[model samples]
Target: MSTTQTQMRREIEEIPTAVDRLLSTSAGAIETAISKIGNDVPFLMSVARGSSDHACAFLKYACELELGLPMASVGPSVASIYGAKLRVPNAVCISVSQSGKSPDIVELTRAITEGGATSVAITNDATSPLANTATATLPICAGPELSVAATKTFVTSLVAGLWLLAEFKQDQELVKAIRALPEHLEKAIACDWTVAANAITGQSVLTLGRGPSFAISNEAALKFKETCQIHAESYSSAEVMHGPVSIVERGFPVIGFAASDAAEDSLIEVADALTEKGALAFVTSKKAKKAICLPHQRTDHWLTDPISTIVSFYTMVEKVSTARNINPDAPRHLNKVTETV
Candidate 1:
């Protein structure tokens, strides 16, 4: 069967439209939350797990870079397991979940809301317990994702969180780029990284990114395991050489995701170095010398570029899974919504 016939592939294809829906319908709620948080919030805290947590990581970078505010990921166990209340006054707490029904997520969001932090929920369900507990909600509007693995919802959550940060920072250029993302994503979905896919002969691979793209790398690594049954690990371009590069052997596959940002050159340099070591490295930048260059769609803002790259990677991974005779829609021992305490 063609990869396009799979539920995962269909959901991956819906990412552009899903993001467009979120951009159009979520502005009012996002604006309202921005007004509630005001301009003087000191710091931000994020609570999430799995793919949603990866989206939070992406937003953490965006918030720290664009708004100049410190951001940290808070463990949900502080509230759910330890029952300790945090004293985060004048801070915004962002919770992300595709399914807003996760017990730990709901409990932590409630705890933070009661502990003097402005709570914001980015979720697909508007009436979930998390939504009811938060001070404001930014529904992802990804619609019903039927696949066990999350594709459209994950991308939409990233868009919603970034949109909130852009509105908060009053970055008009970034906001404009975000509004134009659906078109860029459409172009990204058409990008073919078949050369990179064909190079994955090893059972294990490394995915590298820097700054905001680091979070994208995390999501890519997770998807590689979930949909393609590949043992993939993600690392920051800066940190990989410190410890992780020791494992790279000749012909080992590596995929580096780099955007048009200050860190782009540095990341590409790492990819080139790996390739020079006889590893089969693929990078999404034209600056690569020894590493194979993968086709990528660039957007106006650096933050949005990773989103497009991920959409392209999703397309490529779906094909890879089907080629291996594995169903991307239904992986081994996985489910759609995992609720944990």
Candidate 2:
């Protein structure tokens, strides 16, 4: 059975188009939020959970690097579970969700707005409760994702957040690269990572990345478990050397996601070190000496490179899941939309 037969596969293939749609249609909302956020905001806060939180993790890195604005993840439980009103004055709160209907997310967005923070919602559904509560809403325009495991929506959310950052920072380089991502993503979706897929021997696997790619590693690890039922863990290349490297045995699988950033050399070094230890390590960088180098699509900007890498990874994992006799569309004990308060 080919992966193209599954709904997850179809959604994965639609990522580039979904991103293009988001970029074309969301300019007004993104520009409006950027205009409102001006240069004087003291801090930024992100509200989300699950895959949406991973998008926040990527944005946290991008905002700090590009805009020099520090970002912190605000726990939804601060308002939903604890009923504590946060005093975040002159702060911009960005919330990411696919459905935009999660109770805790909506409640927290409301609380943030009430507490004097400018609220922004990045969601697929523009009419959801979260959108209604936020001061500004940027819809991802990913269309309907029928698969229980999110693919197009996750990528579109990342694009929406990054595009907003680009507009806010007024970085023409990043903005140009962001506009060119659809072409790069098409190349990414065509990348062949079957060698890395075959390297998975069913034992525990470790995925490594640094900076924005670290968030992609986290999402990849989750998708491995969600679709293939594979036991996978994500660690920062810097953090993996601290303790996680001890668990790596001969023939263990390790995938290193390296984008064209300053941390690429560091990630390649760790991947090579794992290969030296006899692990079947694969890295996306061409500079790896010992680890097998997997092919990846690189964009004009480092921040946008991870987007392509993840699209390639989505293709490989869908194949891995189907090879393992698992249905990629519907994983066990999972739903298309998870609502938590």
Candidate 3:
């Protein structure tokens, strides 16, 4: 096996404890970062790209419900060298990155700090440019991920970001709930992925969701495309119906993630539509994929996504990769890290 594959396997097994240790050691930092935010901060605005950007979507939902704070994702243009530019102030601005070296992420941290927003960063890289620039930092502590596709780092970011919400609000209940994440992930790691992969083998897969689950769908597809080299796609449920729905066929495996959040009802409507098209859509609930019929848990989109996403993603990636005799950790034309414009 390749070194990349070995690292991914290790992370799949080791990350549950890393999360626990990070929480225990960084409780103080989490508390300090939250104390710096003011009530005048209308909402939390986050800056990121790729997987980190998707994570920001979930964090956005958590801040609104868990902290009673409205949230938005910064256009990320202002952070990037090329794109439209806008900035938010009196709001807590967060940048999530694994390497903390993405040009856009680094610039976002600098822009917000200069613009007088309370700049914070969550990253796995300790001495990264972003870590030095942020007013406060949350080290995700996912350890060294030598694979191009993010696995444990993304999960840890969700954990670290959720803890940030609880710390800011001193939300004991939510904090307590987060401690169970390690166990939840263990169940996720052990899931049977072969069947799902076989369901859509050699065909394009569509990962669909609404609200926070929309972001989860993106991350799920990211893993499939990046690791398994499959032609997987992700779309917002409403948007999919608009034009992308034409791509779906009976042979296609459609993975649906509906979170316990504001857009749950809309997602349900979409799932029913998928059935009408004769596509086998599998929906994931908090407790496995069992309660697709139950109402969503909370309006916190961020809180619910990782619960459902991590599991479904693990299964889908495994299924596709094993069927092709490919190791997900080692993909053609990709290394563990990249520096691209």
* Candidate 2 to native Cα RMSD, angstroms: 1.1
TM-score of each: 0.98, 0.98, 0.86
Predicted candidate 2 versus true structure: per-residue lDDT over 1-341, tens digit per residue: 55358898889889989999988888999988877674689889999998889899999999999989899999999899999888877799999999999999999999999888889999999999999999899999999999988889999999999999898888999999999999999999999999999988585899999999999999999999999999999999999988988998899999999999999999999999999988899999999999999999999999999989999999999999998888989899999888888
lDDT of each: 0.92, 0.92, 0.71
lDDT of 1: 0.92
lDDT of 3: 0.71
* Per-residue lDDT of model 1, residues 223-298, tens digit only: 9999889999999999999999999999899999999999999999999999888889999999998899999999
Q: Please provide the root mean square deviation of candidate 3 (C-alpha atoms, Å).
A: 3.9
What lDDT score goes with residue 160 in model 2? 94
Runs off by more than 4 Å, candidate 1: 1-4
lDDT of 1 at 166: 90
